[model samples]
Target: MNIVVIDYGSGNLRSAAKAFAHAADEAGMAAEVLVSADPARILAADRLVLPGQGAFADCRAGLDGADGLAEALTEAVTTRGTPFFGICVGMQLLATSGFEHRVTPGLDWIGGRVEALAPSDPALKIPHMGWNALDFEPGRHPVLAGVEPGAHVYFVHSYAMTVDDPAHLLATADYGGRVTAIVGRDNLIGTQFHPEKSQAVGQRLIAGFLRWRP
Candidate 1:
């Protein structure tokens, strides 16, 4: 199998690539993990991973900046229904729009808006950094396969998603209130937390993605 991690000049492409490579090995799947910006390779991918960090508008600009890269991704994931994974700001990009520095349009794959996280506690931080437990339905999604609810996953972000529909929400994490951790439907899956940075729980998630048929 071929897994393509999009290089939009945003995320830690090498780290993500390494994580997937290791996951594939453990899963007993002979898969090739590629970190690339080439649109041609993207279109030919069996699975797609979009990882982003930094500002929403800036990441979007980087993806759009690459010739035919954005369009190729849309076709591969949105049209072809190839199993798609989005990490951090990459997950935020799946929304209809995000208001980080300015109002920016997203891929709109999940129909949501990325907004600043509002923790109920006054002392809580904005960036919601560090490890947090997940709250999810048992046996609800393929990506959460062996990962139990309350499992610790790494997170570091200021903004979170408010999905248009509850059916698309896979899991959430509590900081002071509900923070969307994982969101997906059909062939798409995303995490606000960095699975690469999230140790064992993260590895399980990566392995789940590798074995995921849809």
Candidate 2:
């Protein structure tokens, strides 16, 4: 499969690319990992991976004004039903808005806001970094096929998504309280955790994404 990794000028594209490449190799699938800012290249791919880091506002600004790149992506994923996946800040961008510094509007593909993960305890860290266990919601989804409920995945985010439709949420994690970790609806899937950095479990998740069907 041809996997196009979107390079929107602010993301851990290299790590994501490496992870997908390694997973595809192990899974015996022909996958081409490309870091392209060009929207056409992204549109041409069988599947697209959107990876992100840094500020939400900056990333949104970069993506929105990407000289047709963002528009093409929205069309490809939302309109044409091309498979799309978002990671970390990329997942944040999928929300309706975010309040990091100010209220920044997001892609709004899913109805939600990227809000800070409020710890149930006062002493818990803000970013909620390190290995955290995922609680995948009951039922089947190709991306979480081999991934277990309560399985640990790497996480590093101060902000987390709160999707309006509970049906859109595929998985959650308990940091201090229940935290949304993975989301899937139709052809789109997103994760706040870093599968690329999650080692074996991470590879399995990516492989499942590769194996996902509409």
TM-score, one value per model: 0.98, 0.97
The TM-score of predicted model 1 comes to: 0.98
Task: List model 1 lDDT by residue over 1-214, tens digit each.
Answer: 9999999999688899999999899889999999999999999999899998999999999999999999999988878888999999999999999999799999999999998888999899888999999999899898789799999999999999999999999999988988899999889999999999999899999999888898
User: Largest TM-score belongs to which candidate?
Assistant: 1
The residue-by-residue lDDT of candidate 2 on 39-150, one tens digit each, is 8887888999999898899899888767889988988999889999899988878889998998999988888988878998999988899998988754558789888887
Best by lDDT: 1
**Each model's Cα RMSD:** 0.7, 1.0
Q: What TM-score should be assigned to candidate 2?
A: 0.97
- Candidate 2, residue 119: lDDT: 95
